[model samples]
Target: MSMLPSARLLIVDDEEDMLRLLKRSLTADLNCEIEAVPDAVSALTLLESSRFDVALADVRMPGMDGMEFLERTKTAHPELTVVMMTAYGSIDLAVQAIKQGAYDFITKPFEHDKLVHLLGKAFERTRLIHENLLLQKRVREQESFQEMVGTSPKIRKIFETIKIISNTDVTVLITGESGTGKDLAARAIHRLSQRDQGPFVAVNCPNLPENILESELFGYKKGAFTHAAQDRRGLFREAEGGTIYLDEIGDISPTLQTKLLRVLQDKEIRPLGQTKSVKVDVRIIASTNRDLAAKIQDQTFREDLFYRLNVLSLQMPSLRERPEDIPLLIQHFLEKYSKEFGKPLKRASDEVIQIFLSHPWRGNVRELENLVSRAVLMSPGEVIREEDLDWPIRETEECLVPAEVSFLPYKEAKAQVLEKFNREYVSRVLMRNNNNVTKAAKECGLERQALQQVMRRYAIRNKELLSNEDAE
Candidate 1:
């Protein structure tokens, strides 16, 4: 029941005296701005000129009565709240006005207090509408950059971090598993940077051989190689004054690593079969699914190159880490593919949602997008069902039988049920993770030591779960 002091109200009636009384009383009681007009025509003219929160009109007015005014007002400004005023005999007309789109009706000679209460509720509705519109505007602004959608604290923190670092011209190393949106994050940084007007070039490192990748990164001079028919500018040169995202940087060969290190140290690249180095101005943003630290220890990747790339590191969280965002992501993809495919699909079924929440998203966001896209395209009904989804349900997910059941005591039955659940759940988690205890422990929301204790209780040995090659 909060009153808006700034709420604007419009009152229309042919009776000057009635309009005067209403304008005076309502203005004082509601503490809101009031505009009174003699006829419905004048009121419509005033409405066309100014915005109003609520309108009070007489149902018996001549030459365009309140009912017509209500209809026209609703058609023009659907958000506007209107209440009809009528004489005692015209209560029927007021009821018809309600059917046409009147907020509510008040008879003539009504108590001023009743009108004030009704108008207060109407004003609150207007306020709520305004607030909801503002909220939706903000959500659209937040999601305008890319498909990186999430309200979880981790994702919000990443958003904040990206904004803070966007203005700075520093190397950013985004490390995460494949399909974790590392490329999207790189594009977001480039879009927000001052050099946003320039081109953003992406290079998939593992996609090409070392010799070709080197020539592609640092363009070769004409006649530099077999395809020397034309002079070409490499990806770095193409991204001048912008950003060049080197994806899967960990997979590049040692020779390429050394060349990349030199470029990082001095902002210059020596193109393949070229005698001189060329200076280039481009921001470097690299991402990798491989563990660069492990590669460094194994002497496969250069430590100096790793140090240069790891200047400002951003580790993307896997989809399973932020399960709260799964529903939002699903809805986003559903709407996207639905519109693209011209389908009338609305949402996924509850069973489908449950399956998504429980399943391990190893392929992360990309896997979810592919699954949702396929589901939306293939679903026969508007609602996406479990059967419509192509995701395989694990055999471990089958019903856990209380084998030691059949009229057993309540305590004994409960113990057996708990034991069965623990064993099956642990086995399922381990199987999914390739018998990797650390990963299984994390999926189970337990520390390695705690999971080991549970495993001992169930006599579950990890070695037995491993494949023959892995065990050997």
Candidate 2:
């Protein structure tokens, strides 16, 4: 355990001998600076002029007893750690002092080493509290500018885009894989925009049925549908003079797409139940993981609508593409989850961190956040370790082609050979590593995502490996 060399300690007691004794012990045993005071008045005066980490008070001081001193010190400086000293006859008073915010108490005839140990524990607690505060402050700072949580070149470019376009009224299209923080990017845009003061509405197009989704976006009259109990305003109206984020915009049906295109062009929306078109003054921001250009070619998505939505586009890079930022993201999630779960975990161990950096985060930041949250909740230690995580595993190279592959067509036979190789290779490797993806991936000479994709293609399950391991 490391000591805080700069920590200042106050020894307050009426007996000059007790004060001197404590000062001698702490100064000899601890790295902190110590001062001895004869009475509560001197301690209070010193506290006002200088900062002290911990205060050791004797219970029977004149004018102000240790109990009163502890209470006053707590009220004035709640962060300070206070320990009371009492005789054996007044053990009840020591317990009372503990109830009144005293960190701990020592008996009057305590050993010098025991007191030193107590002071060490107090200093350690103080250190942890300050470290937590500093970490929280850094978390806030890291996410303060537009609340984007990455420092990669790609993310920096997106930040620049947000800064330049936030002041404008241009529509933006954010595209990324699922869990790549598309919604967060949209919020950042809204937060930095001129209509930040207005309501920022969001609609998930795929979550609702076609007819219901329409009414949700464009409100229905009381009798428009079975569930429409009363007249309601649509998202466009709710987002008046603000931004409306349309998540999974590519998932909407052709009919809804046409209506959306009309709304985009005419700046008006006709509600399901209402006959009149409602003109809306709302900015549009859409996000999707689908390939809209390919959809247009496939005739599933409208070309004109695609052009309109793509006026200003920002594609969020996948987590694996920016491996250098993994450490920053991990620390951010560690702090976030620590606070949320009330465990307040510190950084991961070196081995755990190496695994984190090398792991192919298939689910991207979302996966990382979920893993950290789980670790913080379940980890017995204050720091995260490899055992605290559930990592994926890759296949080995022990796969062999079926005997019948030799009789198949040349091209078909080669495909069969590779498939058999991958399935067997991956499955064996997973079994060998007990289904740990990062370690298996490293052993198999493949990225975590590559191994995962192969496992997915073969419909391999980690449970299979775990069961085999159990059998072994």
Candidate 3:
């Protein structure tokens, strides 16, 4: 007989004897990867890191019972095949469990062969689900960026610009408020451009230190600086014959601004400490969430370079301005993140969708994606519900601090609530700035390093905050 492949399983029960019995039976009957947890809390912690094909949970236990556990698992991890174990064998309980999305029920002292049969059926079901998800992904790959999931006139117009200008090597400038999908627009342009086959290099301008940005942009020869141990090619060299996306163009200091202007004008670059300038043939696509015209008035950004980069301009509409796209985006993320997290979630409830529609998506498409990612990870039932979503609470401006600040102590319940807003606000700023702490700091009126500290404190993953310059 052909042996079955190893399948991961989570056995949740308070009875150590029962847990041991289940492990022994499953291991003996089939090749399995098993983790026996005492309760739902432990099971959830394990689920956070591991993907199990099936979770066999007891119906009754202290703290979170099996029924409750089943509800939570189905919500957050709909892809997981769940089976309930109960000693009482009550029909009402079994019916309730089935309603809550339990695969089936196994009464206490069940036959060993029956346990193996149930697992075999669950494994086959999981295999089919995985195969279907993979097929859907392949179908989506041809035209999905997770950014092009809208049908609004504003977004359609942006696509028109991409199609018209992508074939040329003209310097295209994309402008939008922070959270608008500028990065997506840039990538879309490149994907459809003649240079699609070329490398799509993305550089968040302000992320690199000003002192080193020059070398990062332009190649540096050996001995260019104290620690220039070897010759190094710059981003331009890396993007040669392709397109280099210069993000947060407004954040680049005036010094490097001049060098960048020369690169655009002369189509050549001089390596630091090298006499000869190398001729480079590359297309430039630059994006900025900042207002270059206003910066030009303030003299923080170069006017000549602004005109050079704006040879072909595309402006992305913000999420609030295009409410019609919200549903499409939510639906897209429901499928996108479902496949991404290995959890096939059901469509969001109307209440949840309404919340998404009514709320001002200040963070834009990227924010919506984050919200969905969180909801998918935390929802307890097969479908995402309102409580699973963490809505940003409204803060009062009357008190420079939270209105409850005086009544609360540091790290208290209300104080932690305040931190939540700060976390989200800082996250939006960073996403808007393309994770460039310098630019985000300048915009948020905090120091570059200070903004970074805030990100670290809230565990706001800079990389996880995805934004598309004007796509927000």
lDDT of 3 by residue, 124-205 (tens): 7777788899898775553344358677788777777888988788999999876678998999888888888889899988
Native RMSD of candidate 2 (Å): 11.0
Count of residue pairs whose backbone atoms collide, per candidate: 0, 8, 20
Q: Give the TM-score of candidate 2.
A: 0.63
* 363 Cα displacement, candidate 3 (Å): 1.1
Is 1 or 2 the stronger prediction by lDDT? 1
User: For model 3, what is the alpha-carbon lDDT of residue 335?
Assistant: 81
Decoy 3 TM-score against native = 0.60
Which prediction has more favorable TM-score, 1 or 2? Answer: 1
The global C-alpha lDDT for each of the candidates, from Candidate 1 onward, is: 0.84, 0.82, 0.81
Better of 2 and 3 by TM-score: 2
Task: Return the lDDT, model 1, position 356.
Answer: 89
TM-score of each: 0.64, 0.63, 0.60
Q: What is the C-alpha RMSD of each candidate to the true structure, in Å?
A: 11.5, 11.0, 14.5
Task: State the lDDT of candidate 2 residue by residue for 158-219, as single tens digits.
Answer: 77888787888888999987667889889988998889998899998866789888888888
| Residue clash pairs of candidate 2 | 392-436, 392-437, 393-436, 393-437, 395-425, 395-426, 396-425, 396-426
